[model samples]
Target chain A: MDTLNLEGTEDTPKVILDKENGIFELSGRSLPEDSAEFFQPVLDWIEEYSNDPNSETVFEVKLEYFNTASSKLILDILSDLAEIEGTTIVWYFHEDDEDMEEAGEEFSELVELPFEFKTY
Target chain B: MQTQDLILIYEGEFTQDITKAVLSMAERNMDSSGEESSVKRKVFNVMVECLQNISKHAESFDEKSKAKNNAIFMIGKQEKEYFITSGNIVRKDSVDSLKNKLDKINSLDKSGLKELYKEIIKAGKLSEKGGAGLGLVDMARKSGNKLKFDFEPVNQKFSFFSLQTTIHRS
Candidate 1:
């Protein structure tokens, strides 16, 4: 699959999904006005990537903040990845951000996937 | 009349640009107040959800009100807690549902709120405006307090809805 790269905006997050390199990243803040529209393509790409089944996938998620709408879409992304094999999710949070940390823990509990929490 | 504790007040149309400006202003104010990063983050998070809620639900009032697509947002501090309040006009029909939602959210404890948040997210039902209807749940969870709100009838067709969330500094 071709690499899907999207630039982040004031209300959106940056996304880079490289199938060949097995690197999937979503960083920055995500609070788009229309989250479903903004995340539709990303979800589509992930669905397509699931078909090929990368040998090893590293999903890096470093989000400063996201609205509740984006939160649901994020869980959708994580749930999709949970079905694949050899998928590792790296959840990043600021050292002092308890909300984000709890968010990571909640997602960890909801999904059956390998999650590594890293604080910056 | 504005209260002495008022730190920020914004009344106007809520666009993406306005949201960014408000967030920046609130961040600067919070920083200057010498709050810890965690406290500031909580305030910021609650503010975002409040603003977004207004932007999503705010309806244009009748000509008599002279406020078209305009909402009121205010941030005030009392002692060690910060209060964020937002008021907007909504269709009369939506008042009951909105009030019920807030009541349901306010009744939950932290764990209950967390469970509701997870359930809503997993259900994946976005609003017509593409929201997961998790804003109220998030506000309750982040503030660790019940959401206070009221709905005042404006006219037969519209009502003014107000919501307030409180964040304690620790």
Candidate 2:
């Protein structure tokens, strides 16, 4: 699958879904005013990637701050990953950011996928 | 009034640019004051919800009314907590539902809020404005406090709606 790279903005996260280089990560703040519009391409990319996923997919989510809208879309993205076997989510949060940690935990509980929590 | 505790206040239309500017300003103020990362996240979360809520729902009175698309946002620092307050114009007909939503959120306890959050996200009901109706719940959950709100009638068709969310500094 072709890589889907989107640079981060003040209200959107940086997304890198490069199958060739084996890098799948999203990071930064994600509180776009139009989250659905902002995340549509990402959702589409993930859907296409699902058809021929790698042997083991380790998607990283290193968001500092995301609004509730983005939170729901994050869950959707994780759900998509859950459908693909051999997929693990690497959730990174700031050391003192309890809310982000808890968010990751909640996503782990809801989705049937392995999650590794790391603090930066 | 600009008091020592008053961090920032904005009143006018809520364009995406204006929202970003105000949020960054508040963030800078919080960072410079040496606020803990956790507490700052809570405040930032609540502020974003409040401002985005206004941007999405604030009703314009009429094409010619001066209050069209106008709203107010204020953040202040008290000794023990930070308060984020927002007010916007809304149609009088929409007041009841908005009030009910706030009341329901304020009445819930922590675990109750967690359950509601989970339920709402699972339901995945995204509004036309790109909201899942989770803003109020998220604000309540992040702040860990009851949402305070009021509505004042502006005219027959519209009212001024105000909401306040508080995040403790501890």
Candidate 3:
């Protein structure tokens, strides 16, 4: 498919999903007022990408903070990625951000995908 | 010495722009005070939940009745901890469900809260308002405190609901 890139804002995250380049990452803060609306295209892209996913799909999530509303969308994204084989999640959190780390753990527990946790 | 400082206070209609501004103001306040990164994250997260909760109170206001459309948000810093509080108008019919949710959240211990949070996140369906119903649970887990709330009937159809969440500095 085509690459989907979005710039981060005060209330949204930076998204870079490139199936050709093999880069699927979401970074920065995510606290959109309407998370379902904001993440709709991304979800659609992931659904489309799953059909022709790369051999070793690694998705990186390096969000500093996300609202509970966005949390559900994050789960939706992760669940879509889980359907593809050989997919893994690289969850990054700041050394001082225990909440982010725990968030990664909770997402890992919810999804069947393997997660590699790293501290920045 | 014990001192209580009011960091931020906002009272008006809760819009998306207001939510962003409120969060950024609270974030800057925490930054200026030189709070630890962990504590600052906790405060920020709780504030988002509180503010969003107010935005979800759409039934409290109707175009015909303009008297009950406003909400209040305040953050105060004490010597040992910081507190985030919010009050909004809600429909009388929602009072029972809202109270039940808060009471259930307050009754749980840390581990219990964590378990409940996981359970809800895994299975809870999103409301039309795009809420996963995990805001209160996440707030309790993040602040590591019991959720305190009150409801006062205003007329026969609406009630004023106030909620307070506390985060420790340590």
Highest lDDT: give the candidate number: 2
List lDDT for all candidates, in order. Answer: 0.89, 0.91, 0.89
**Per-prediction TM-score:** 0.93, 0.96, 0.96
Model 1 chain B poorest ten-residue lDDT run: B60-69
Per-residue lDDT of candidate 1, residues B1-170 (tens digit): 54448889999989767888898898999899898898888898999888888888799885666555689999998777999999999999988898888889878888899999888888768878777889989999999998999999998898999888999989
Q: Which stretches of candidate 3 lie over 4 Å from their true place?
A: B58-69
Question: What lDDT tens digits, residue by residue, belong to model 3 across residues A1-116?
Answer: 78999999998999999988889999999989889999999999988888888899999999988999899889999999899999999999998788889889989989999999
Q: Spell out the clash pairs found in candidate 1.
A: none
- What is the iRMSD in Å for candidate 1? 1.2
Give the best candidate by DockQ: 3
Q: Write the per-residue lDDT of candidate 2 for residues B39-88, one digit (tens) a residue.
A: 88899889888888888888887768665458999999988889999988
lDDT (10s digit) by residue, model 2, range A1-120: 788999999999999999888899999999998998899999999999989989899999999999999988998999999999999999999888888898999999899999999999
What value does DockQ give for candidate 2? Answer: 0.81
Error of 2 at B105 (Å): 0.7
Off by over 4 Å in 2: B1-4, B65-68
Q: Which pairs clash in model 2? A: none
Per-residue C-alpha lDDT of model 1 across residues A1-120, encoded as one tens digit per residue: 789999998789999999887779999989887888999999999999999877888899999999898898898899999998999999999988889999999999999999999999
Clashing pairs in 3: none
In model 3 chain A, where is the ten-residue run with the lowest total lDDT? A95-104
